[model samples]
Target: MLSITTFILLGILGLFLYLLVKYPDKSIGTNERPDLVGPRGLPIIGNLIGIYLKGFTNFNYENLTKYGPNATSTSLGFGRLIAINDPECIEYVMKTNFENYIKPNLLKEALNDVLGDEKCGDSNENWRAIYLTQKIFVKLFEEDTKKLLNIMEAKVQSGETFDLQQLFFRFTLDTFLKITFGLDKNSFADPEEPVRFAMAFDSVQATIDGRFLNPFWKFTEIFSEGGRKMRANCKYLSEFAYKIIKKRRNDPKALKNPKDILNIFMNAKLEDGQYLTDKELRDIILNLIIAGRDTTAQTLSWMMYNVMVNPAIEQKMVNEINTLLSNEKPIPKYEDVKQFEFVQATLYETLRLHPSVPGSVKYCLGNDVLPNGTPVNAGELVIMSAWAMGRDERIWGADAKIFDPERFIKDKNGLKPSQYKFVSFNCGPRLCLGQNFATIEFMTLTTSLLRKYQFEIMPGQKSPPDFGNSVTLPMKDPLLVKVYRRN
Candidate 1:
């Protein structure tokens, strides 16, 4: 029996060897090709042991730099996952043959539980709707939300100490819902507000956490913990959207010609001169809610933490706000916020230090070779670690880790950003559509707080909020802020 078992194992090994020798492109071994092999991994499990043990923090970027950008591959599972760190190689993948790489099915499956079926999360047709609505309506109408800004400023002026992260998250959530869905679920003021949509938003963070930690939760497989929550959330969100869709479809009187995202969508006609389905509109609304709420909230959390840690920079910002708004009326306009250059720099520096979306995963559409001569197969997963890339010494220079906003003011050639290097909003066709809108919101919110209250970190507290993985990086601990109302 033992001899027979040994014979079978040896035969299988021999077959694998034969395949590699016959077709080098199909196998894991090749000297002529740049393959990233670290230490030996177990069969089936592959290098999951390393990934599981290291988890999030154990992900070593230094190892990649030492091994040439294209030379090293991280063993994810059945396939060898390629890691591309070089800026030129990233440019090639993101721009050169942009369509050849796309968001993997796994991501879509995971996000679909939260994002809905509209393909709004997709880079294609649905995204076009999102881009049009956001660019034309939301971004263009920066001043239209003055009423909302007035409310937030009033709340701040009343002298309440609040968690800026949660407050801003709720603010954006409410703003996005009103802007996109025409529903004013003021989640910030009333925490117990039973907005079914807020519950749906929770699925995004959980799914993001699961994507990094659990390998079993593939896109197609729906029984995973995160997947289950996502499906539930989607069902609720869809039902709620269907109600609105029914109202809009059945009753033309219900459709308000108000200047909001949904109103524009109601009027939108495709290139073929056809109207979009109710499901399409709902999906678009849900996508914007997720995008506007989580990304901006997380970015603000990191920014607030940075302000607390770097008191000098924080004071500079406070001084700028006070000096600018001192003589003027307390209620500042959106244009008034633009003059505070230090605030802009601080936000840029925060994005540099802790980008909301650290990495993006793309699957090769077909066979392609990276700039470093690493061949990527059609189905292999390519991870572009934005966090690692942001902190890359080659790009950011010697004081990469330091919280200095001046770096953005000057580039490596001693000029401004060369268009590709500072990619917090990404680049190319897939660049963030709501970039200007988000910036406006961020600066406005920051200006609102800076002009009045001063946030100082409590003694013996960790300066920057402890970062952990979710759809967006948020505070592991509540960002405890002590507020002193500045006249």
Candidate 2:
């Protein structure tokens, strides 16, 4: 008779053998074509161990560029993953054969656990309602911006060094809550206050990102400490969302006016001519909040970091803002944001280097070949690394790694690059609906802040902060900076 430990070891060995026999590894380039190159993987587990060891971001960068900017392949468990940094290949997956690819079920399940059920197919009415509501609330948004600016000004007067990333996150969250739900979180007013909702939101997003790498995350959620914490946070977030939704639904003034995005959704009808339920409304609002808040805040954080480290670039931006706006009305208005070309260029450059969402994963639906002659079978995962593409010499030329805003300025206007190449806002049918709103919000805040003050890196700090692991790219460490009134 075998002991308990021996029995456990024998069970593991038997499972490994079963997997190996059931799902044999298919060698790449088995046909007449050259093999797609990537880091070699072990049978069954494939590159999971490598990803876990090197860290996902580093592993992606090192392995994706091992053989230049072409598409590379590796196996994860029994599934095949092909990572593409080449512009043409990205276009092929994102645009040309768009219908042949979709968000993977595993990813959907992970997001759904936190974000609620994401409605699919024909959401035009819902989008239009949200857009119109946002347009109407532009003035309110401007007022909120002024309030945040005042907080920053107070910080400058006190001569305190604070994390601009944290400030941006708070500002966006507060503003988004006000505009979307007609509720003022007022996080900017009391910067030190603990924001449990925001913390929970971040934790859930990070946990969801981990789910992409771990196939057995469901089991882990039940047994692991981190996984249990994530589950609790998700519950907290859902309860908060539902509470706000119920309050809004009961408020007669809110329902009567329907000024905020939530009210608009509640009153709006679905494709089947039925009003959107509370659950659907909650999902839409939360999804929009995530979309609107983090992307804008993170991009602003990265943009400020870039400007501060490069004095020349910062000076150019300051000069542009000052020259464009009159002293009487320094803060940019909604219509005025479009005219600040160079300022917009600087924002574009920041996005180019540090896209908020560094990479996106798409699942192949049907067997097809990419433009570069890479064969992709049905049920394979195609990971597009915007981070890698942004730095690829083949796409952005020799100065790809340099922080230069001039790359986006052509003939005194913002140069438009191919959607497939500059995929920060993504491309094709799924292009970000909040692009205009985000731009206006960014420009408004940027112009208002830059006009009054200058940001300097805190003493003993370094440039180019390390990236945090999440669904989005955030600074691993706080972006501490000192704010000073411009002389």
Candidate 3:
């Protein structure tokens, strides 16, 4: 009787095993089987529970090891996500097959909300125009960066160590506004100025970060108070930009090409040979303001933070700057300032560690397979987490997370990853247009600030600012350092 009952139990167990294998969950198991395995997740939510509820900091090394080089997908509320660390695969997506991917509607709309433009409008052209305009103004910016250096020097001399990040934001905002739109509110000195368009731009960045957390709350116009404020700020930015453009248009001198971005923008003609409307002009200008201001400010903050943490890098930068300007005046002229090697290395390292626009989303314009054999369907969004890619041990070797500036000098093969793998400015046609402009600004601010003061982390102060792991990493509190004169 025992033998017969045991035989019956074995039969039932075999039947249950057969059902489990035949009818497995479809989300984790690919529709058409692929060469990758995703993290085991809740039936529908996948990685969403970890991203929003726990924050990225909570899942650092553990997640990467479990998920392989490319491990982000859509489940729960995350529409479509992809995190990549393979250099060969990233090269294919960003370069070899670049045309197949473009920024999606959701991203474009978030940027549009920041600039007060329509959701489905001709957004690409405006970004292109801004890129073209910044190319013209980069020369002018390298020229105007001296004034910002002098201003920073003054702040250093006064013995007031204010929030360096905020100060850099103000400086870059002033530079961008003046050079791009020919509107200068001088908000660097007075944060509460009525025409503080930079604050509006910051509001937009916050909204963009918020969207990533809870996508269900995505129709930002319907829910966010910050969104409403951003719209209002966009209104102010538009009016201010148009006022300048109208003034230029009425002036006879406007016919001639002036040396700034505003002149080129004013005189530009579209494919149809019609000039941009005031609304388009405003959107384009605001977009430039945010791109130019935020990227440079974040980079400068990161550079300073690294220098403070790694005293060796700071001394090297100071020595390089002093040696280059040794024969010249104490305040190095812009032409003379280009000779600093260590400073350049410091900037490169900072960009690697904390890229301002860390990661970006690329929507597949059509169906395509990445070099790593991951097939992306049309209309699907694939996100390249630049932050994750930078910190990957495979890419930068064992010392990936440590703040070391010398890694950029040379590798064993004497090849540089500056362009392909460590892509802060990105690569291919869609690369950052303001790359040179941002570098020059970072070089100038970092050198000038260090020349006047030697700063130390306050007692018990952490090395890098606790940025709370947002879309673009930012300081949880303002970066406050104790300052001392460079005697």
Candidate 4:
């Protein structure tokens, strides 16, 4: 006679076996293209186990390199994924046949909670109309940079090691909030509201990344502790966004200024001649926050890490900034930043090695052949590995792994690479509208800091920090550094 516990255990094992047998490998159907090459997958589960163990960025780069210089195909249990690293293929998919590929429904569903159902909007007009001028950008961010420098000065005076990455995240969040909604979040001071909002924002982003790996995340989210936390975080973040929207709607003063990005959206008319709904405003604001905050912060963090690790590179950057501007005029004007060729080159190099959005996925709306002759079927996924492309020896050079800013500097001006090749800002029609703004911000902040302070990586810290698994390429560990005042 079996005991109750024994019976339950046996039944659970039987159910697991039943699922394995009942579900056929989804990627093994007629849609599987034999010409494409990749790692062999196991029964039912496919390469998900491998991806889980190896990490997303590493797994994609390793397999894509081994199986292809152009493209490779694999399955992640749910469906077939064709990973493309070739520039020509990327251009074809992102540009020539852009209409045929769209954000995957699975991805949209995962992100919909935080980002709302808003596709990229026509932001160029808004940017041009209000904030494109050099003076506006300098005016908008100068005070924020000063605040940041003051905080770093405090750290320097304390003679304590700190995580620059965390500081950068907070700094960018404050600056972006100020520009986007005309609200000074003061994240540098680490107030309760802004800190809590930042934590919730980051937690929700990590949860969304997890969703991409697990097909039955909906069910898991109900029963798991992590899922419950994710739900709570999402709720908090939503409330935060809506609260801002409600406050802005009532503030007639907000309309008169026309300084922030929110006012532009709020006042604009749609095709239907109606003002944006509160929900639309929430979506746009949240999306912009994620874009403006994470990308800039993470890139700055990585750039600093790279500069610290390479002393020669750091010296060159310091000399360039110092020569261009002095303590008398420390904070760079937007035009002054344009002249700091070495600083700009360093930024481009950092982005090439550690793109903020390391990779992007597009769903094929119809069957099509890529420029590289890779056949992608409708319902399949095209995974463009920006990280892989950046590191690829064929695309860059034999010394692609080495950090070199000279690659971007030609005759003392920034060399413009093909959008497909240097795709940190993305390529084609969907090129980031904030490209100019982000560049100016990067150069401005970087020039300002290097002018006054020097950085050293804390002892025993890992060389070339490991990348975290997130929508953006964040350092896995806090980028701890010892700050020093420049003589």
Candidate 1 residues lying further than 4 Å off, grouped into runs, are 1-34, 37-40, 53-71, 74-78, 117-162, 191-196, 218-228, 253-258, 412-416, 460-463
Task: Using TM-score as the measure, name the better of candidate 1 and candidate 3.
Answer: 3
Worst 10-residue lDDT window for candidate 4 reads 23-32
Q: TM-score for model 1?
A: 0.81
Quickly count the clashes in candidate 2.
0
Q: What is the lDDT of residue 109 in candidate 3?
A: 58
Candidate 2 residues 1-487, lDDT tens each?
8999999999999987876764444323222123677766655556777776665566777776676565454545326677888778888888889999999887788888777775721287767766766657677768877887788779888999898999899988988888788888888768988798799888888888777767688888898998889979877877787898889778877687867777777777777788877777778878888888898999999999998889998888888899876568867777788888888988988998998788888889899988877788887788888788888888788989999998887523356778788999998888787788888899988988898889988867656688876888888899998898897
Q: State the lDDT of candidate 1 residue by residue for 84-146, as single tens digits.
A: 677777887888889999987767765765565754334355445555555444343343345
Question: Predictions ranked by lDDT, top down?
Answer: 4, 2, 3, 1
Model 3 score (lDDT): 0.66
Tens-digit lDDT track for model 4 on 98-181? Answer: 999999988888898878876524655655654544366467678888988898898889998888988888888888888777
Q: Lowest lDDT 10-mer window, candidate 3?
A: 23-32
Give the range where candidate 2 is weakest over 10 consecutive residues by summed lDDT.
Answer: 25-34
